[model samples]
Target: MSRGVGLLLVVWLLACSGVHAQALPTQVSGSVSEAKTRLPIPGATVQVVRTKRGVVTSTTGDFSIEAMPTDTILFRALGYKSQRMPMGGIGLSQLVVRIQLVRDSVRLGEVQVISDRPDRAIINRALRNIKRPAPPVVSGAKRPPKPKPLFAVDSTAPKKPVPTIASPVSLLYDQFSREGKQRRKMEEIEAEQRAEKLRKARAEYNKAFLDNRGYTP
Candidate 1:
């Protein structure tokens, strides 16, 4: 029984020592800034090199991450060179770090572009070489000339009598009527000409009136 109690005490001590050796996770805070300007760099990537855990900086270039003392942190941002820092020697529970990022310069080479378009003249020459069939010709027998009218008009058929003026009065009346229509048409033409002349005279008078009033019409 005494031996068992001694063993139990040894186990308890070992468990307590193990719990004491394991450290609690600590929060690390850091800011990324430009090296020359010393201005905060936002949206920077902060990653643990060993565990692959990562976080991004806020708009104010501030970041907080849970990390162990044995981990190494990596900082990266656009237009800036990447930086790696070891966290083992940092002793504070809430560690605050200020990181400066250097600018990276890149040089590009000249580039040339070339284009080739097919020749239109060569394509047209190729199309003209293709053979085509000739148009068909129409060939048929000629129709006989139409035969003469079967027979001369039958002499036995009565002839239609020709009409003639029965009296001189109708002819004279028709002549008088034609003369009257011609005279009326002449009068109408003269009236239209007079009206047109009057219109032209009115237009000239109006133009003169406007000119006298110091206005051009």
Candidate 2:
């Protein structure tokens, strides 16, 4: 085969194996309706989670979204249930879906969340706060000079705080030192016991030796 013919064959093979992107932008248009009542839901926000792009439903509950590669659209309508619908797997597929959103039942006993702490009836009853007006600002006037005591009868007042051996940690440290000293004394006592044992052993051997010599000591 000629070189040009081989190159042509290679190009044809490559084109056959590869897939091309949609030559134009694809649009997916749809209407949102209540699943239970079949009523149109207006102002619902629809999003393509895969592409992070979305659109809102119109007054008539109609919505149009530009489809992106590998997109799964999620729809959220207030007072109605959310929905998800998959579109176009790898290639552009024309889609016209009628999304059904059901109104969520309001369960009075269900757990409710608030952005900030709301005053509960139980808490409001427990707290009794008095609202006081702000004091007038004194800009230039000097605060009345604190009046001096009219009479100074005694220079000293009884100590409010009973003389605490202010250094409690120092006392603890001293107690720890005393305990350490006691531990060392106990160690010395144990050593003395071992030494006494040795002395007794020597005395017994000497007595035995004297007995063997036929001279009692």
Candidate 3:
């Protein structure tokens, strides 16, 4: 009986000294969220600083980890500041510890936009080379009379036999006459307008190219 009492005392002393505590790891469960909005931060890493082992928070921002009182745990997530806490501070009696992480601001470096087209200088030069046609100058030229219709149509007068088809010689003369010169001038004006439109279109395209890349020049 005395021997049994002594053994019981030794067991009680070992229990009080926490000799078995090392074998029993503390279960640490917690949640992480955005501090300002109180929104759960899923995929956040909960790592043990000493062991480097970690666990990721669930979609609901819930996590469970086994750690010792002496260990330090770190909570980290993308786009948010990391947090550290001592395991001892999270007492065993505490249920779910709520960890709210502040949003971390990240500044990015300058971004370079690459393209296959020519640079600004080359594009500008190309646009400048497109020239408008000059207006024609007809010095000492008189306004030519309108040509009469080849065949006149009248209901009151009896229709005469169809006039002979215009001779080839007359056709050639009309093509090289003042009327032809005026037609050519009108064509030059149209060409100038078309060239101006093309220049404007190119300028607009360059502006848009720069704007899309956030470039100014």
> How accurate locally, in lDDT, is each candidate?
0.76, 0.71, 0.78
Per-residue lDDT of model 2, residues 41-83, tens digit only: 8899989886688888888999998775456889998776777
Each candidate structure's TM-score, on Cα atoms with residue i matched to residue i, is 0.46, 0.42, 0.46
- Ten contiguous residues with the weakest lDDT in model 3: 154-163
| Model 2: CA > 4 A from native | 1-18, 22-25, 88-90, 106-217
List the candidate 1 regions with Cα displacement exceeding 4 Å: 1-22, 89-91, 111-217
By lDDT, the best candidate is: 3
Q: Which stretches of candidate 3 lie over 4 Å from their true place?
A: 1-12, 15-17, 89-95, 116-217
* Candidate 3: Cα lDDT at 125: 95
- Between candidates 2 and 3, name the one with more favorable lDDT: 3
Cand. 2 TM to true fold: 0.42
| 2 versus 3: better TM-score goes to | 3
The whole-model C-alpha lDDT of candidate 1 against the native structure comes to 0.76
Model 1, clash count?
0
